[model samples]
Target: MGRNTRKRRSPLATKVVAGAAALAVGGGGLVWANFYASAHESDSSHHRTRSAGAQVATIQCPDVGQKLRNVPRGARPGVDKELARLDEQITEAYARLASTRQAQSGDSAYVQNAILGPLKSKRTAALDRIGINIRRGGGDAPGGLDRFAECRGMGADQPGNGDGDGDNGNGNGGQDQDNGQGQDGGQDGGGQDDGQNQGDNGNGAAGPFADDFVDINDVQPNSRDLENGLAANGDGGSTGSFTAVCGVNENNLFNSDNLIVAPGVDNGAHHTHDYVGNQNNNAFSSDDDLAGADTSCQNQGDKSTYYWPVLRLQDGTQEFDANDLGGGAEGNVGKILKATEAEIKFVGNQQSDVVAMPKFLRIITGDAKAFTNGVANANSSFSCTGFEDRQVTDKYVLCPEGSQVVRTSNFQSCWDGQNIDSANHRDHVAFVQQDGSCANGFQAIPQLQVRLVYDVPAPTVENGQVQNPYAVDGFPEQLHKPITDHNDFINVMDENLMNEVVDCINGGEDCQ
Candidate 1:
């Protein structure tokens, strides 16, 4: 009887001690859960103790984890691991949380105000560690930016160019730190800057966190052809003669502004034109021998020189029969150089075509047509009747500077001459003001207003995308012209800043 009592008492004592241990562990875990949430909130501190505490709370002790496996809270097996594995992960997560908190929490004015950024290795490293801990703890995975597949050792997500908008739900202009981070530890600090920089009339942002930085809208490509030489100037392809300068037409001469009326002036030893059409128009009279080219065509008081980009408001043009090689000509070149509807509309968009007006605002300002002697004009005839009318009416003003191809009634269609404030008046101020190349006397279009915009990359449509990036040359010296080649245009875009205009109608950033 004595032995039986002693055995029963010993077993009861063991059970009581185990029960007490279990209760203590559960209560401590409850305390630790609170610690986890608090540490996450006040993570800006360098609290080593807090980190160590977090490490212990997160550890997945297999003994506890397996026993609780059937429990609702343990369904994820979120922390199931042997003692060693549990310890490793807990330490890692805590260290990472500590590092990231320290990096972003730094308070420096220079760090806040830099154009590029507070570009600190510490910040980068911190972001990396946090991302690593998240992945290790099995948080949500980045969708296409698969960190495992693309990220290098000790890196974050690696998204491409257009991915800047992804995961940034608020459009706050800051990239998802884990999205664009690359192999080399956030080397390119350009993540914060918009695609284009220094807009002509843009709100200069202090930095990424500023209120008003948006996409650029008027970026133009700079070409070698702008300053030193024009594109294929000497080629039989178009503008001028191959081996010599040709005598220019006197009747159709103009200045860069297209508004100049050159007063009486000498032709400077070279044979000047009696009346020649613009290279863009291809109605040029090339029968005369080549002569020295007039170097200065933009000055206001020169008679020998006229204006450039000689725009004509043509409601109807018969010469388009010949120039529309795609429509009337027999050569395959026409088929190859076929201008699609997208290209046309893209040009119109860049020129800010009045959406309310007839889409006849065919934005033909920068369009070019090469004169292929026989192959081009084979079945078509030039507008002799139109030329005859010009000869008699406006004193034979051959392609008269600032002339209209519009029907007499449609003359007003080009531009509303009086309402300078009209949105349809063309935003030409950005051209000269931003370009920094001209004086105020840009020869004004007689009855219509001309708004000049620089950086119109010769418009093109390939692969269903309209690649007309109008870039502003921020170069200190002379501002360059548009990059015409498709590859070159894309290359410049991939490298430099460009304009992004929001469609007033659509209200979305327009980038190509």
Candidate 2:
């Protein structure tokens, strides 16, 4: 077992959070350094080729680059080798489809294919859970750009929230009341400061994402920061989070187009519980306060992707685990990790100090940072406070020192905010933005990866498996659904670029 972490014994107060902050400590502040929390995992490991819900050590994830506290890296990191391994597994899956087909008579075979055409089919169910995509034919070529677009969708092109005469309160340009910087146009507000988080063992090992694009010698892959955001830590439970450090940019060492989305179905994938089981103490101890929470939150996909991924310094210094900080739902930008479908409360299951955001379409080449500072560092739009415990989403700019942006939240969106709840914050979409934090000469916007404190709910079958949409006459599983624009208003994706069977039942318009 690794050395256990202690929640207390810390220092370097960044900002004095209210008593109700989600990860709140007693002293009206978020400890920035000297945080030692001893955490224990009670679950035992099982063998015999586990499926999605298996208790395994940090073994399944592929390493990107992991080392102990700034130690130099070896010739290869784990991620590269795993990608190669994944390629082999996916290929084998394709071959399995053919062999399985041989064992059946014409009708049985036809029935089998008709029933389980895609990886989601009963016949191929096991294969899909193991990260394999076995369709009637095969997957699209790896890293195919157009296909990638179909899955991730363009950011700026997305239609605004459909409310009223285009003036319904969807985040728009109205000088959004800059507290420090603007809302990054993409990011929401509600957050805090960090000092003890990454400064733990020096090397400034805080978050899972590192800024090696500038130095390349500063990457640290293995550390506490990396361990927390991983699924292996969940003891086979579905709450663990994944972070990955792919070569999104050669010069910057970040991904500009990366996205991660949460499934909204109750008990959907990436389910989690938020802010559960925390005693109000005056001191801040990282005692897994958010663990065991009775809530979870799921959001729209393709916004930003933040899995716990590790990195190695160009100088060869090792850091956190490769899979510990970075690795998640196959880069789909919509797969779930830490979420509970039914109740939409956000949880803290992921590990890492600062939630890192990439400059839009541009990864950081140097000084990779999560920016525009201030209370914007907190998650969601609100925090909790007081004996009655009212929640408030206090939007403040860390860089400005004064409140430039000041937006509050209703309980409908967030749970609470900015109060002395000691492990209490609201559960809502982010409300802050990044202004002037982009890397020079990159893309039009900033790409982001947040190290979420996942507290997800268990995964549930959608529609009780009432229908297997993948089954169709004369259609490949990959070609079942056609992403047609609905009267140029609502639209859906084609199967080759889709995951679930489109609910063509209602045409999705819910006409009043």
Candidate 3:
């Protein structure tokens, strides 16, 4: 895809909320899986992680008595003029913030404090002035532009965004680590301050990890392989069951200065992701990067960035055990590894043809916010001892004796055949039907699935406390909390493999 084509996007008709610049991806630690659909159909079967009926705080501007300006509802001529002027002022203020001193790539607080902080104050003041102007002009909210004020710093997941009803999960507010580590290499380390790696405190928390630490071997055991339940979807492509083994692309795995979450927001992921296939991929990594980065794929041209949160394991002993990675500074999560293979599979859609995904299109599956938001669109599965069939949600299942634990995620595969992205990032794609056929107007694409198998040891109980052997990377210090993890894929497939995938799906032939 050319840069010019990628750059063509609709302008923001309404002002985004203030503090938007600081809204990191997975901000508050809850990944905002902002997938979209024209209309969200609430399925009773696939429940969310949180109570669907939970109430979310409504974001609004300073009350201007009886009327909130509605941007969609145009204002009176005079009121419109004033609103336009204020919009310009707000835009200018944001520009000023952008021009402020630039912080180091991973310095999280620099943007929040120096840029967003001051910009918020200025915007809030300007909004307040707008209210005064509206009053002076003898108008009520000048077409609900007043409501835009409520969106200040709020994400698309928040309420009053004209989207469907669903509260963004509650994200825990803490500090960011400059050295990118906490006590003893734990996340949000709350115990003894045996300071190791320390980073610029983003949210003013002492560090990412606490004083206490748990070895990977010490974590409590969860699910394991079930007898006869661990079978792969046999008979492969005849029924749309297949696997695409994207080989290990070591060069693609690195500490990214760019945050993959909010590309516009610097260091938006806040934490680093283990990237594969694309060495130059990062937040703010442009079409140029996508077009230019080296690929570890056999094609030698595919640069799609496949990334996920970092995983950290304990070291040999206390003398070496650390929770840091990404440069392994003291107080940092240590030792990132490249997966031997990222096995993307297609299950359920046995009869659908795999269409080629558009270049530069971004798609995310699963919900990182699932933990706090209740399980929605969850396709997480687990296995042990090479058995791949067991799947469960919510609680982790203890594996059978002698089996290692594993996690699997399957992404939605039906596409609209038109738009590569939508407002919510999900509307453009739909899941295949029970028979594995795409809905009318949607095309079948290679169903992408990911499986992560860890080398965690057996669980042990110490002094009545159960230590699970495996936990996801980037979680808080607590062990085995039901986590909401997700995956992201930007299509940079080389034309050869892309065509082969399409043929496999269309011809009803399965191959690894």
lDDT of each: 0.17, 0.17, 0.40
lDDT of 3 by residue, 1-512 (tens): 00111121113212322222232221121111111111123445533222121111111122221123232222233333333333333333332322231231224344455444554565455556655555655555355443434323221122122221122111111111111111222212122212321211221111222222233232324433211112212243334445555564544344423333345332223234666667666544677778787765554656666677544333212212132111111112333444544666654345534668887777766444332232333335445544444344333335556665566665667778876654335656766554555566777676666777655544443331233222344312111122345577888776876676666656666655
Candidate 2 Cα lDDT to native: 0.17
User: Any idea what lDDT model 1 has?
Assistant: 0.17
Question: Residue by residue across 379-456, what tens digits does model 2's lDDT show?
Answer: 122111111121112121111122121111111111112211110011111222222111222211111222222121
Worst lDDT run of 10 residues, candidate 3, spans 1-10
Best by TM-score: 3
Worst 10 residues of 1 by lDDT: 483-492
lDDT of 2 at 507: 22
Q: Candidate 3 regions off by >4 Å? A: 1-245, 256-260, 314-341, 346-348, 396-402, 461-469, 474-481
**Residue-pair clashes per candidate, as listed?**
32, 128, 57
Task: Determine the C-alpha RMSD for candidate 2 after optimal superposition of all C-alphas.
Answer: 26.9
Q: Is candidate 1 or candidate 3 better by TM-score?
A: 3
